[model samples]
Target chain A: MLAVDMAGETVRAMNGSMVAYDGEMTFKRQGMTGGEGLRGALRRRVAGESMTLMEVTGQGTVYFASEATEVTLVELAGDTLLVESDSLLALDGRLQTGVQFIGLRGMGTGQGLATTKVEGQGTVAILSDGPAIALEVAPGTPLCVDPHAYVAHRGQLQQDVVTDVNWRTVLGQGSGESVQFRYQGHGLVYVQPAERGGILEI
Target chain B: MTSTTFNAATLPANDNVNPYAFSVDLNGQWFTQKGKMIAYYGQIRFQALSAGPLDMLVAESFHSPLYAHDWIVAEGQGKLLLADRGFDINSYDLDKGNLTIRAANLLAFEPGLELKQSIIPGFLTLIGTGRFVAASNGPVHFVEPPIRVDPQALLGWADCPSPCHHYDHGYVRGVLGAARMMFGVGGTSGEEHQFDFTGEGTVLIQSSEHVTSSDAMLRELEGQIGMLGVPGLRQLHGTIAQRLAAEQQH
Candidate 1:
């Protein structure tokens, strides 16, 4: 659970994520066009990345929670965060949210063909099955992460699909770690300790 | 929890990042269960146990034919992170000892240990001096035997004789009890059955009675069906169909 103090400032949160509030607060459903406007809504609709958010404006502290999952707060400063729409919980109202096409790499990960891009300045709250671990991706040390456990990533990093598939995979005797996201450059990758079953799980 | 960032240099060598995840500093090889690896840094290569190059290593240490397809050998130098369905993961060291664990709970083990199928169904025994990782639904409790534990809560036992099924006395005490058991009419307290353990050694039990789903267990059951012959197989098929029909009704 996350408690956000509001002093007349607004925060956009996941729909129905508000568990309780101490003072007066009003939640207005984000309009037909998401917070990013019609362009983001159209891209999200096209890419199958849909997020339902509500604008919370009040004078007191509001608590947000979703299904008792653990929450991770990422403070972004003019950098972009690529996260799954389903994992997004809440974010500062000042941030801009959009959808970015992540190409074929997303297909093998079971995260779809696009991911929600959160940019601008403020904290973005993401949910994970367990506490998310942050791994630093530096110049020479590339990180390979199971797509199913991947939560979110930020910084100037290049994400590529690394495949170790061979005839063994075809014979149903392949290593389950055949598909992975190889992240390089400079950035931090957040991965949940638990894996969300993906296409490769079979 | 505050997010602490770990780089390849800082990731622990053969240790846990938290209660739910473990990190292995892989220099040579680690036998890992399929789909347990969450992430890793540095250079690493995952090969199927059936792969040709790993034939010698697997033949020496891995003896469980029933679980061959469910395992892979991660070979190379890197920091490997492993987790299982968000369960609490812990690494246990075997100093030239034997330990049997639920097949579904065993995540990965060092190549120094020899893994074989235990006599008990849905359990595997590791013999040798090495390290292995296992995940439990909750914190694992170690208790001495002369104890009866909920079957679902029993993780595994070390250096002890296998346990036997123990049913509550009330389950068969009277005519009313017998009738209720036969018809399945009355609601059960769900605490009548337990695993009775005795003799020396330690018994491991998870705090929760929730067992992870195991397709391997189903396969083990299927493998044992071969000895039943035609008549017994037919009877078992009929019984299973009836059970499936009953389940669908609910």
Candidate 2:
């Protein structure tokens, strides 16, 4: 499930039920435009998932800590780097966090994992298969993130909840709507093309 | 966890205390109704022998809504192998500064531990596992237990019934009052929304003021379970009558 589209960096199936993600990978997040029709374009979305397009950028590759136990995102931001972990041994992207209101259970019980944030910043690296998109999130804008597939964001204006949405009859409608991550600040949030969590690893 | 400056209120003005929870200076804003754009860093940790199928520690919030930052979530679940979507309850990017989110553990859709981007603004998340799907700003927005009683629908028990009002009690006094009086709760926010979920199944909720999390409110609400024991549980006469009179004064 871990794929890398970057040069030199590779996604290989290693010995034992593990995958080896070596080399550098390229990845980026796309935003939701053309409000009319938008279904998550990530190829690996689950059947009943509510995926949305993102307006952020990301890059990285997948690494294995041990067998199917976990996956790691090795990515870079400017001169900084990020290394994140995931529960799905099979996921490919420059990871981060976003709307998990629908996929909360997937990330729980370690079923699906993506990232962990520590205070401050550090040199983090990620591996993924992508054509990295570099977007600028200014002070008045912010982005929402999924913990699964993201790298990092600098800053943005934002709000913590999309707590209210009338039930929609659309694809990923009211069943479990996204809590709005309103971006009104001067920061960029990292997002992925796919909705990548919510399956039971076991 | 973010860095929090704690000047020991219990200790001394110059002293600092960093237990799990501590107070921060709000610049006169923390105690007021208006919210000042602020940043706070802190962590909540519990030493327990049990792990996995983990549960959130339900705690009463000490800071007023005005004093707390708009966003507060479990930045990380610590040094154990957390399940995908590592459990979370967060609220961030309070652009409107209107709503406070709460909930009893919502699951992550990203099954693998990876970073994710949200469609909503002013939000970003990190998953212990890349397993993520969707998350709520406040999982406790809805009544813990949806009032299924037919009479409420019939009696206009829901003041606004706009569906939005049902989520947060900050709006719609009649609806909020009815919900709290009926369920004996206003709502759950912060860590209070997290419950001891042994398995997978949604727990009902109700939002409110005095009682945010229903663990206590429900206990006090035990006074009404007897009504269910009687016939036509859906119909309320005496209990609703008395509680309504009491709530109006508050």
Kindly list the per-residue Cα lDDT of model 1 for residues B130-231, writing each as its tens digit: 999999998999999899999899899999898899998988778878887877767679898998999999999999989888788888998999999999
Clashes of 1: 0
TM-score of chain B of 1: 0.95
The TM-scores that each candidate's chain B achieves against the reference are 0.95, 0.19
**Superposed model 2: Cα runs more than 4 Å off:** A1-84, A87-115, A118-122, A127-134, A144-151, A154-159, A167-177, A199-202, B1-250
lDDT of 2 at B201: 20
Best by TM-score: 1
State the lDDT at B55 in candidate 1: 87
Give lDDT for model 1: 0.92
Give lDDT tens digits, candidate 1, residues A41-154: 888899998889999998999999999999999999999999998999999999999999999888866778999999999999999999999999999999999989999999
Count of clashing residue pairs in every prediction: 0, 170
The lDDT of each candidate is 0.92, 0.27
**Which segments of model 1 are wrong by more than 4 Å?**
A199-202, B241-250
Docking class of 2: incorrect
